[model samples]
Target: MGSIDKYIFKTTLASFALVLVSLTGVIWITQALRGIDLMTSQGQTILTFLGITGLVIPALVLIIAPIALMIAISHTLNKLATDSEIIVMNAAGFSPIRLFRPFFLATCVVAALVAFIGAYLAPDGMRRIKQWDAEITADVLTNILQPGRFAQLDQNLTIRIRERLPGGVLGGVFVDDRRDPQERVTIIADHGTVQKTDRGSYLVLYDGNLQRFEVGKRDPALVAFARYAFDMSKFSQGRDVTLGIRERYLWELMWPDEEDKTYQQLSGQFFAELHDRFMAPIYPFAFAALTFAFLGAPRTTRQSRNFSIGGSVFAVFGLRMVGFACSVMAVKTPLAALVQYLMLFGGIGVGVWMIVGGVVVEPPPRLMEAINRNNERIARLFRRPATA
Candidate 1:
């Protein structure tokens, strides 16, 4: 690569890295705040939280990579124009296509990185996050109860304990269980402890009072008991992970079931997601080109800098939103998919047109005359004194 190309490449890459990190940090912070309470309630260790956070990196990359690339290219080119480097290059007989090569190369490298993360790393990370979340939920469900507190296990079960014993035992226990809709039962025990048997896990009570109230009957029956047991195993089932098109791999989406109607719908969604993942990386380059086509100009005047940079950034954002809307609509209308592809091709066409269309305008005659006059005055000011 020539000196100018190398210079532009380095500048663009530096900008891209800065933007990518800033954007990813913002996203990570948001996710961390939202999940911190759930993690603490589940008694998850720091390492577990970090691991899950790490697993989210690819997902963040999927959103950050394209925007970073677009911003980087726009900023770098704008800087070059503002500094008159582009003017010098043009003066040296370089065309817009020649100047664009470095930026395009950088875009290609970023696109490759995005593709790798989207196609492989993202799916694997999502799976790990799901698995860890499920394990944490199970732990919380089984171990959240504490002594001397009113613990509500679910909608139908509540238990209060006065104290915890050495083992998994409780003293002065009160239990209200309403699993049966026809009858409601309340039990009070002077002492109780959890027990695991061949049948299931249960809480065995001693010296307790039992009250049974039938739903329809007005009469409530009370019975005093020396021993009583209530089953606790029924509440131990872990939470199920939600599997969506984003969570499944390509093959799972394609062949969810041979004979299920839901599978066919899922298969369609998966196909759309797969195509989107593959297409996401290219968006960076396409957006970069589109921005450049609209913004690349020789900054011969102050107005040119403001016009090109502001207009380019606004146009880039607008195009991105349009593309996202089209992708969403594509889920229901196949024609929207064509629109997405057209956006990409349209970006390329714009770039090619910019390269082939020649510079937007010749340097203003008045500005050129003023610049020449300034040079002449400077030369005269620096001249040797006339010979004596």
Candidate 2:
């Protein structure tokens, strides 16, 4: 690569990195806010809250990288034009293909990043999210024991505490077990804590009494005890982590087990996910080409570039939206997947042709005139009345 190419490549890559981080951070904050219960109501630590929320980042980047790349390409191209660098390069016989090399290289890097995240990292994060969430919920339900609320740990089991004390002690503990239909057992304790043994989890209560009522007997029996261990193993049972189609790794999607229940039920979704991963990497390249085709042509300062910039943004997002629609439909109609490929490659092919042909894309003169008229009216609204 020439010096100029290296400069453009570095500039675009840096801009992409900045935009990706800013966008991801903003969106992640929004998602993380929804999980604030992990720390507030769930009795979890801040680290635990952040860890669970951070798991969604890989998936976010997989969706955001192509858009960021487009923004970065547009920024770089506009910067060059603003400084008259593109005009100079054009006058010096620098073909659009030569100018495009650096942008393509930057896009290649972003595309590879997207591919890796989609194929492995994103799904891995999702799997970990499920596992961590299950473990946290079980821990909270069985161990943490929320205060002042009757927590339904199981369909037939409920527990509550008046207050949580330091050193993992629960005060004024209440346990109601109705798992046995033939009898009902209620236990009241002054203090208690959940303990795990080799056998399983147990709620060990201090200074408690248990009252039991059998199905055949009308009278209830009360047993007083200094200490007792109530088996909580049933309430703390681990949930089966069932991942959705978006949570499956690329290999899992590509070679899905026919006998797998999810695969059997959502076979079309499996197909869509597989093709979506395959197409993820291609979007960055197509977006870069399209942005370049719209704005890379040299133009004098007298000519406006806003229309071209808007056109590129619209084209990039429109194509992506179509691809998304195709993905959704592809879940039912397998052939719908082909439309994305056509749109993607068609954009790339046309973009490359326009770039090489030095096509200066602009809106129709009548449209520009109407836009100018609207702009003048809006500007008049904002303008200050001549210093009265």
- The lDDT per prediction is 0.75, 0.90
Q: Write candidate 2's Cα lDDT for 191-251 as tens digits.
A: 9877877788888899989999999998999999899998877667666788888889999
Off by over 4 Å in 1: 140-148, 152-242, 250-262, 359-388
* lDDT of each residue in 82-138, candidate 1, tens digit only: 788888888888888778889888988898898877777788799888887776555
- Which residue pairs of candidate 1 clash? none
Point out the worst 10-residue segment of candidate 1 by lDDT.
37-46
Q: Which candidate comes out best when scored by lDDT?
A: 2
Give the lowest summed-lDDT range of ten residues in model 2.
136-145
lDDT of 2 at 8: 99
What's the CA RMSD for each of the models?
10.7, 5.1
Can you give the lDDT of residue 18 in candidate 2?
99
Work out the TM-score per prediction: 0.69, 0.82
